[model samples]
Target: MNIDKPHAGNKFFLSEISFLGYVVTRGGLRPDLQKVDAVRDAPTPTSLTHVRAFLGFASYYRRFIKGFAAIARPLTNLLRKDQPLTCDGECERTFSTLKEALASAPILVRPDHGKPFILITEWQSEAISAILAQQGKDGREHVVEYASRTIPDERKNDSAPQGECYAVVWGIQHFHPYLYGQKFLLVTDHEPLLALKKLTNYTGMIGRWAVRLQEYDFDIVDRKAEKHGNADGLTRLHRPGKVPKGEEITSWKEPKQSEGLEYGQVAILPRT
Candidate 1:
């Protein structure tokens, strides 16, 4: 029972302590500044480590990049066990694209709970979705942020008019609790704004949805498809296969017959 003699159970613990002491005496716990600087200033990865670091940063801002996980699938495959990752032409292109996207990542401004939020949504036949949020302040409306995504094929064919409509509903639902009794505007390119007035029963899923929508006052306005060109392009970028360039060029024509709604005007309809 001598204190100098280590018990069998404590032998492993003593060994760990001895090793740690040796390490500490050999060098302080802090890393070598020169080595640390070398690592920091080291050439950016044109290889596996670079890809992983870029992916890590991309993940940090996943909200800004819709369908980010899906988009990075190919790059992630390079990180799997025993897999040889080569920075071939294709990988190099992707690496450059991701780095560019990361460098110029858009700064999203948080929504103001007090100001009215306007959501512009776009729906595509392919089940892609995009949304742009603008808030009214000081007698003017300015874009607060943007978000977009491509829904799984299975989920696309649902009764929802467009992926953007679903996206809009989801965004509003997310902010509903904070915005209860607050007024907001739902902007869409869909033509069925009048049909939404037919909603009466507030019980089933659709009804519940209507109820939640009703809680916070909202008016559906037609945002001409052409006007949302930028957002539409972003939604297409999330689409599953290669998307051709110049497909986003759209010409917005003035409505032939006007609802006569002026910009920034809100049209409120009586709840059905």
Candidate 2:
């Protein structure tokens, strides 16, 4: 596996270079401009196979594309056996949007193992998304990666609390590789979720998700949805076109109180 396979994109002793279809430099990792240009220039797919091929290429750089799964969900729906392969208005709009996103995609920095991470997950009416990041030496928060997925139709009717709980579990698992073995902050706009650590197996869905999270080392923080615009990108892909009824978020209090708003904010929880 030496220069014996140079075409395979092997490199050595270079601070900045293109490796496996991405640009690597001090700034961060980004998709090769030529590849991005090809996607932007490609025409809309007219068949199932063509759609799959296009998605395969776009997925290669999904790490740099936020909410990629939700954005591509429309096209994926067309791949269903019971569904027709025709590209509709929704599919066409999604295809162009994905290309535009890739064209202007952000540069993602690699994680710093020595530093702590901040994970933000949000449920925006129709989808769930999260961003795993860390503050770099330069004092700016750098993104390790972005994740998001469309909410299934059956689950759309779920209660807001249920959705919020799911986001915490889903987000942690999605970014488990970077989050495991380190203490991190799990930011959420839902204050009720702030009590996540207090739940047990006796609780319903939230409790179950809590059990799954016991092995991880992290704390949940409450940030109002207005200020939560950071990880709110992906959910906008679905046009629920509605906002949650305004609910005031209370400031998190020190843990170990009995006010028990049932699902109010809790600053820190200790293992009993």
Candidate 3:
């Protein structure tokens, strides 16, 4: 390791250092104070170039923002082809929100390999999001990372339930390196996931997703939607149009249980 200020001094010690727009301390990693202030104090972007520059700077610390992609959607849209460069009301609001989110961003800790993780997901008609957190020694959950994205045009027509399932699959895959070998709890408000392992009649995307999920070690637990605030906030922020209508799947019922193993646990699935 190369140390700065390598003068004739015998040794130098420092408590912490700021590197690449992040502060490193014994406690955890946090966005550098100066960078946070820069984002907060930045003027509302007036053109596409300005928007992109601000986004480029802000994107560096996006993991600190709970739903960054959703929050910045309006501003990003300005950069799309044929879109106007003007900062509309939505764009201004998004810019402000991003600054606020960054200014108040939390200090995230390194993932402790010894501890188990918790994965929570949310899905709406427009976007899907997930949060990875772990219980700290103080018994409170701390966020490891957040992920969210707008639904592409090809999937805009998926039902809400399917979207939820998609969120799970996407979330798991996004954090696969963190979760591959560990046992983690998968929490969601969607009840269909509780019966996911036993459903024999699922078709299309949901079926393919379920098959893929069987390879992971996890337990699916249902939590009230209100409790999933982080991911819920992400999905709700960037909904762009009227939700897909008449795509509801009303026939999925809770599967009957067999033996001690419930359908929600990760167990060997019969080959399709």
Provide the overall lDDT of each model, using Cα atoms, as 2-decimal numbers. 0.48, 0.74, 0.73
**1-272, model 3: which lDDT tens digit per residue?**
44564657444466677887889877788988887776677665433345566888877787787777778877777666555333445666788888888888898887887999999998877678889999998998888888888787787888877878888998999999999988998989998788877768657888888888888889889988778787781122212132234211122233456633222121222222
What's the TM-score of each model vs. the native?
Answer: 0.49, 0.76, 0.78
Off by over 4 Å in 1: 1-53, 63-95, 125-132, 136-141, 159-164, 201-212, 233-272
Candidate 2 residue 140 Cα shift, in angstroms, is 3.1
Model 2: weakest 10-residue lDDT segment is: 263-272
After TM-score superposition, the amount by which residue 252's alpha carbon in candidate 3 deviates from its true location, in angstroms, is 50
List runs of model 3 lying over 4 Å from the truth. Answer: 1-13, 82-86, 233-272
- For residue 154, model 2's alpha carbon misses the true position, in angstroms, by 5.6
Q: Look at candidate 1 and tell me the lDDT of residue 129.
A: 39
Give lDDT tens digits, candidate 2, residues 194-267.
88887755467667778888999998899998988878722122122232223122333453555432321111
Give the higher-lDDT candidate: 1 or 3.
3
lDDT of 1 at 17: 27
Clash pairs detected, candidate 3: none
